[model samples]
Target: MQINGAQMVIEALIAEGVDTVFGYPGGAIMNVYDEIYKQKDFKHILTRHEQAAVHAAEGYAKVSGKVGVAMITSGPGFTNAVTGLADAYMDSIPLVVISGQVPMSLIGTDAFQEIDAVGISRSCTKHNYLVTKAQDLPRVLKEAFHIAATGRPGPVHVDIPKDVTAEIAEFDYSIVLDLETYKPHVKGNPRQIKKVMEAIANAKRPLFYLGGGIINANAAYEVRDLVQKTGIPAVETFMARGVLSCDDQLLIGMLGMHGSYASNMAMSETDLVIGLGVRFDDRVTGKLSEFAKNASVIHVDIDPASISKLVNADYPIVGDVKNVVNEMLELIAGIESQKYKVWRETVQNFAKLHPLTYHEDTERLKPQWVIQRVGELLGDSANISTDVGQHQMWTGQFYPFTRPRQFISSGGLGTMGFGFPAAIGVKAATPEKISINFTGDGSILMNVQELMTAVGNKLPVINIILNNNYLGMVRQWQTLFYDKRHSETDLSVQPDFVKLAEAFGGIGYRVKTKEEFDSALKDAVEKNVVAFIEVIVHRMENVMPMVPAGGSLFNMMLLEKKGEK
Candidate 1:
């Protein structure tokens, strides 16, 4: 068969099992968009902003465990995707971003709508290429997908010139991808695995610190099995939330800054810390010297750079998380479960003493209560996305995720306006499962135009807005650290979210009390159309158990009441 480069690109994407793509069409990419229209297999999501398209693709990839794909035009369209590419790079997300470039003949003549996308994205992407010839399209695409999805998983770019899309080529669907420059480490060394197993067996107080890599590698069951077999308690990072059931006896919840006191204490007191697929980010380690001072660290990761990039490890194994865990499991297959009864008892005692708790008032609907109720309603099946702010932290503290990839949020980037569009992407990827977006009043206003996209696509995602009438997180900081002088945090001038939803042709409800919240939630879940629920919460309320910026985890401000200072 023979086809143009644009058609060949779409065919290659279909062959790679890509069924959904988020993108915004523009002048330079009209040819590719036309090819997309001709194809019946792929579904395209039109976003209000090109940036949202990239973020939606990221959310899809995060939840589905697939390489997310996004398409855009040259110049401004390509520029808009830079932030998303950087975010994915920082978080190690798998993404294939295809951008339309100017014609090859106008390469150095400063053609209209022309910018070197490959050059611009090189710093942030895992790999990139400029497809000048039509014959190279299929092979380049296959290699791009391979590189983007394999080890360390990050964004990859393919810059397709407008003229190249129209060039005809012999499109043979059968072609092997051979890239000498690109190879990802997948297998762990047997010796290293044996050493880690021996350390695990000998340690009296061993802990497993899981990260997003486990989810990316689809090793959740293996992780759980290893923890159960060794009788070792496990804690997850913010990005790795829901890797294990929160109620599981061996699960110690999240650790590090803003984590539970018991979790932080457990990490600090451990004899050995087995970190799997997790980077020791500053948010997780706090003062590097003080982090797990008593523990001998064994780090396993696919990216060799991350092994000793932060806190030095006693043992470093570079390989895929699933492969490494499998190797370790094989090494310790028949070993009897060690007795950590004392360690378990100590952790449980701490948990009981400082359990996660919040006050509930019947007079007003609280964000924490709403999140808890939603968690109960959805059980362990629903996928939750959150925007950055007070609601984001509230969801982190309140929601109970029983599996990996069930909780998706912008932890590293802390990008506001990430929730609603992310929920749309999650719903698109998993159409049968219910998806919810927990958003703050300030965060929602950043990309509220995405509400129209949700309604247009008929994606029935429940958007829960925690209306605090101010930027809750910043206001709390101002109140605590800055003489209680609230400056520029007021959000009272914002439009009514309920009316906004109505104008976007979606169902809207406002809840003021607990009863109203419960009723509205129930109604929203049952409704077939996209729904938005705004819960008015008390003003000037702050999130407790806070470690001030650049402060040690041990030094926390436990504010119990208003005006505690």
Candidate 2:
């Protein structure tokens, strides 16, 4: 059967079982858009900006456990999507971006709306292709999907020329090519599994440190099962928020710079750290030499480079996290749980002695309380996302995620404008589930234009803005480290968020007190419309249990008791 390259693109998408595509159209990609218009097989989200399109796709991918697809024209359109590509690359999110390029004849001619799309995207994407031949489009498209979804997933780019899209091609979507060099190890070595089992059995104080790879590998259940069976305390990274239920007894809070006092303390004391699907990023391993100093690490990750790049692993298992963990579980099945009664007691005491506490005043709204309330209101139904700032940390601190991929944030890149657009994608992917964006006053404005995207699609996502009238995170750092020298951090000139939401055709509310917040939240939940609720929080309030940059994790600044060096 013969088909145009544009139609082949659609056929390839259908073959890949892609149900949704987030995109923005331009002259170079008009043919693809025209084919998209003719097709009823997939839902196309027309985002306000090219960046939002990618972010939206990320949100969809994060929750759906599927490779996200994004499409845009070449030149500025491709350039605008760069930040999102970098963000996805950093976080290892699987995304296949199809970009339309200028006609092949215009190559090196500096044609209008032409840029080196493949060259520019090479650094950020796992792999990229420039498809000049129409007949090769199907195989390249298939390869793009495979590359994006395999071996520590990341974005893959495919640049198609306009002339190619117009050319006819012999279409054969049924052919599945297996590239030998692209093989990913899915099983852990038996010897490595035995070593991990030995570590689990020998250690009196065992800890499980996790990251997004668990969720990406669909191994959250295995992680929970491993911890439950082995009786090891666990601390997750920001990207691995919901791997274990928040109320699980063995689960300590997140481990990082803004990690809970208990989690940091527990990490410092552990004798064996089972690092599953996590890279020991500097933020999590503050003052690397001192981080888990007492412990020997058994790092399991699909990416071999991540195993010892930052923190050296005693037992490095290079395979899929799910496979490695499940294999370890099988090996340790009949083994008795270690008698770590003293260790458990110590961990519990640490959790009790330095609990996550804020000045709980009913008069003024605290960001922590607002997040806690949202967590309570949404409960297991919560599918929350966040932009980078104080609010992001606050949600990380207070939001009790009970399921994997329920909490989505740009952990690696810490992109500011990610939440609102991501929330739109989440809503689109799972319309029955409730989606919310916990954003800051500063971060929300970065991609607030997506409010129209939500309204246009009727996605009915709720945006809860923690309005502090300042860049809260930077202000905290300035207050602590820089002698309170407030520079451009103060964001006093802000739009009335309520009116702004209304102008964008969404319901909005501004709440100053807990009573107002509760009411607004209830209204947002019941209304079933795209809504924005701005909760005014204190400007000076900071996320506690913060391990200052270059500071030891053992030495943290608690809100109740600030230790002086």
lDDT of 1 by residue, 431-548 (tens): 8888899998899887788888889998888889999999999998899899999999988997877889999999899889877888888887788678889999978767766767
- Compared with the true structure, all predictions reach lDDT values of 0.86, 0.91
Q: Candidate 2 on 18-125: residue-level lDDT in tens?
A: 999999999999999999999999999999999999999999999898999999999999999998999999999999999999999997899999999999999998
Q: Which residue pairs in candidate 1 have backbone atoms (N, alpha carbon, C) closer than 3 angstroms, thus clashing?
A: none
| Global Cα lDDT for candidate 1 | 0.86
Poorly placed runs, candidate 2 (over 4 Å):
333-335, 561-565
Alpha-carbon shift of residue 228 in model 2 (angstroms): 0.6
lDDT of 1 at 248: 79
> Scored by Cα lDDT, where does model 2 land?
0.91
Candidate 2's TM-score reads 0.98
- Worst 10-residue lDDT window for candidate 2 reads 556-565
Candidate 1 TM-score to native: 0.96
**TM-score of each candidate structure, all chains considered together:** 0.96, 0.98
Q: TM-score: which candidate is best?
A: 2
After TM-score superposition, the amount by which residue 102's alpha carbon in candidate 2 deviates from its true location, in angstroms, is 0.9
